[model samples]
Target: MERERVNRKIAAIFAADVAGYSRLMGMDEEGTLARLKAHRRELVDPKIVEYYGRIVKTTGDGMLVEFPSVVDAVRCAVEVQRGMVERNAEVPQGTRIEFRVGITVGDIIIEGGDIFGDRVNVAARLEQLAEPGGICVSGRVQEDTQGRLEIAFEDAGERQLKNIARPVRVYRVRPSAAAATARPALTLPEKPSAAVLPFQNMSGDPEQEYFADGMVEEIITALSRFKSLFVIARNSSFTYKGKAVDIKQVGRELGVRYVLEGSVRKAANRVRITGQLIDATTGAHLWADRFDGALEDIFDLQDRVATSVVGAIAPKLEQAEIERSERKPIGNLDAYDCYLRGMASLYQWSKESNDEALRLLYRSIELDPAFVSAYGAAAWCYVWRKTQGWVANSAQDKIEAIRLARRAVELGKDDAAALSAGGITFAHIAGDLDGGAAFIERALVLNPNLAGAWLNSGWVRVWLGEPEVAIEHLARAMRLSPLDPILFRMQGAMASAHLFAGHYDEASAWAEKALRENPNLQQGLRVAAASHALAGRLEEAQKAVARIRQLDPDFRISNMQDRLPAVLRPQDFARYAEGLRKAGLPG
Candidate 1:
């Protein structure tokens, strides 16, 4: 006999899951299982019952439920998630038991007290699209729950669902705290302005999430190197992290005209990165591209991705910047003076000068902590010390470097000087390669005329595996500061960039220029030796090595990581080490 079809009615579906269920299980079976049961008993079950929700079924790591009202469902979801945040206060990010929630209001078949329909399916899909500690809901659910609930929703646009009939419009639910502390909508910049939104880590492994962030940060720094864009600070842009964000809303919040977004996926030593530039005002795509490479070749991959994005946007941004500069007035004199004084000390490029520069910077910050340039210069002092091999205490220096860089980025969101300096140190000292790049780029966007930002940006680009772009940026820095007292530093960096790119002759030429000003410069001597050795100029390479030995008779290729601040990538460092070995550096 044929069974009667069940009647259909409107229902609110909620989907919930542990952020990293498999990972949690892999890390600890009995403990994870115990925690899940304890959470369900203490929190999840109580909320479901209180909100008039019916538990349809339970998967070991997730649950599906039907609520009588969308309001009840959303409220319960938010509370449960918020409770988790408080529950995880003492827990580290690496192993937190965060929950992602997805709610939808839709039609469902009522059969034997179990619901079956696309509404339930949509909720599941939205959950998949949510950030680890966030929530996602369908448009209808957001609409029905609006005004009825005190929650804020961000339009995530249409997402293609697996095994679904059509694209679904999803919105991300912002945490209550984020909404409470939200900045007043900003005034758009007169010039071209942009914010590189944090890249999505499409890689399922939570450990690789930082890789994606680092990539975005590099791109932001790269784009900032261009003098024409008003770039928002990394901290501001990151406010949207783990939230489903509307592009237009991001523009309004950040006061930027353009927005760049992307994703990174890594698996089995291979990585695929994809990015798109958008006209935030029009919701139109300006540019898009994908980069694929071996994971070990990550530095090169990041450079190519960043270079392409920068090349695509330069013309448009330049036009906007000129327009804005015409409308904007100059900076404050006292603050500017203090910043310049700090710069004077920085340019001296010795330990005593670095110390003096730091003192001047501290006074500048005291006078006006808003002077982002001073913060950048201060952070650079630490980087300089590390590069010159003068830091006697690595651990304490690293801690201080990170603390200062974090503060510079926090307080100097609109300042290019602050971002670049802080961003570079974050990489070298804190090992936050992605974050450092982002801040540096933001600085470039704020004040492209800042020659030092370009100089430091060039150095990081080489570390990120874009020696070609590094050379270009350094060249621009030299042009901007034709007679700069620190001109030798620029020339030496250029030499290293060329050496990194395997352009031996160009490396040799730039190194010679650097040596002309500071004959004892260790960086210039090292690059000249390495490039000459690799290019088969054995006599010249040996001569360069002899000079290097004169400066530091204890130098050896074996201690390359400790000695060479520029070698962040293993392959590049190994290649340079080999060249040093060939040039007869001991060990």
Candidate 2:
């Protein structure tokens, strides 16, 4: 007898088992084993090695492997599936071998050259959950595998497993084409809906990819404010990043009826952004434009791109709105360059990013004090500090935020960003909800492409107890800024509005969808909890409450007034409060 001791480490475990293996073996035992051996030797093993994965054990019909990295595990899984696909092409569909693979990353006990732990068990269970010729992965694997692989994952939610101590979050992974084809085509809701696809970096310079992506994001942010758009989050849209995709396929995968696609090319001293809008169902080009400008005038270029995109989708969008979308700094374009850098920093949403963004934004305003957008960006830094609890004096930050926001509006009343920021600051910090809503609405009318304006307007309406109207505006915002990072805020607003209207099911569904994009979205958790409670789902409501506390331990309705827009109508306030209470929110 020999004894061995080794420390346990967290690793991605990949478990796979052949589907219908018993039937195949029963049909021809020797042939089945021989074919399986040959496949492993010739195709599967090499790909696994190529992806830097190690095989731990092999059952006659299944294999268990350990990957040093999650990226490798995912890549190996995708390649194995792809290779299997090619190998199966020659055989009759019914006679071809298929595999169901499951991946999980967690701590596992290693003993006697065999792996053992709950993690292993979870992977095995997930493998069982996978469809034939498909891959299933634990939530841990999903989080770790993003940005490192070219795979698409559909949420399977929590699943109950036999003998498993707890339910597991699972994601189903399949070939992108197969997944798109598998989705049932559904009619668009009467509501406004849209999808944002990754903008192609036609600049030829790889460094400019981030710039092009950032511009798309800004456009999405502007549209998200409209409150009438069903904007897909950036993460969802960016999944198609660097992939050749069809507009119809994008719509089907994202469940949006309209699609926005474009390319960005930047030369030494000139830049051009070309965009097109298409009806996803018909694949008909609804609108197209090419924006060319000096590199120094990048801000103006972005504004033009946004205006053209908005004008194409909603012909009724007024010229005033287009002008608002085109608003930029009145002084040096250098300041605008700094502003873009500031925006890039802000997108990171970290302490370091915040500091860098604040510094750059201040520099932009210093160079061009008349720059209303810079003021708005500065106000946002205060908002971020306050929200993140990084402010030394919350009251002071609120006052400064309100002042800067108001200044932005005064300086650029025609600018959508200025109006949007001013309205949000007034509603959330100044406690002047009606005034804020009015400003946001004015901004929206001036630029239907202003997603932020629509989103803010929708928030105001929801606070005023007009949920149906809010939903429309939010949907429009979504359409304009389908790839915005903060678009989840609009989704949460929609859910909140639905909850207040006593549309519990719709509220829950939207909230779930929002959380799907951002699991830690506080507003989504609140709305989801309230919706579940209103629908008599006490367990679910409690679970949502638990999640809320996990994210914001000190959260309560009493403090919500300071945190939320104050423009809500009495009825709306009461309804929202009631839902929160029912959802187990503390008074």
Q: Which lDDT values do the candidates have, in the order given?
A: 0.77, 0.77
- TM-score of decoy 2: 0.55
Error of 1 at 20 (Å): 70
How well does each candidate superpose onto the true structure, as a TM-score? 0.43, 0.55
Number of clashing pairs per prediction, in order? 7, 34
lDDT of 1 by residue, 1-587 (tens): 99977799998999989888999889988888988897888778888997999999899889999998999999889868766765677677777788888889978988887788888888898998889879999888888877666578899899888878999889998744555575434445455677888899999987665567656755665555555556654545665777898897687566677888999998888999998999886699999999999866665676676666655656545444323322211144355455556665665677788888888788877877666656666877888887766777877877777777888888777666678789888877776777777777877767775667788889888889999999889976864444454688899999989988989999999999999988878889988989988999989999999998887776788766666764378888887888888888889
Model 2 lDDT tens row, 31-134: 77887888788778887887778788998788899888888888788767766775676577666788889999999888767898898889999999988888
**Model 2 Cα RMSD, Å?**
17.9
Candidate 1's C-alpha runs over 4 A off are 1-340, 366-371
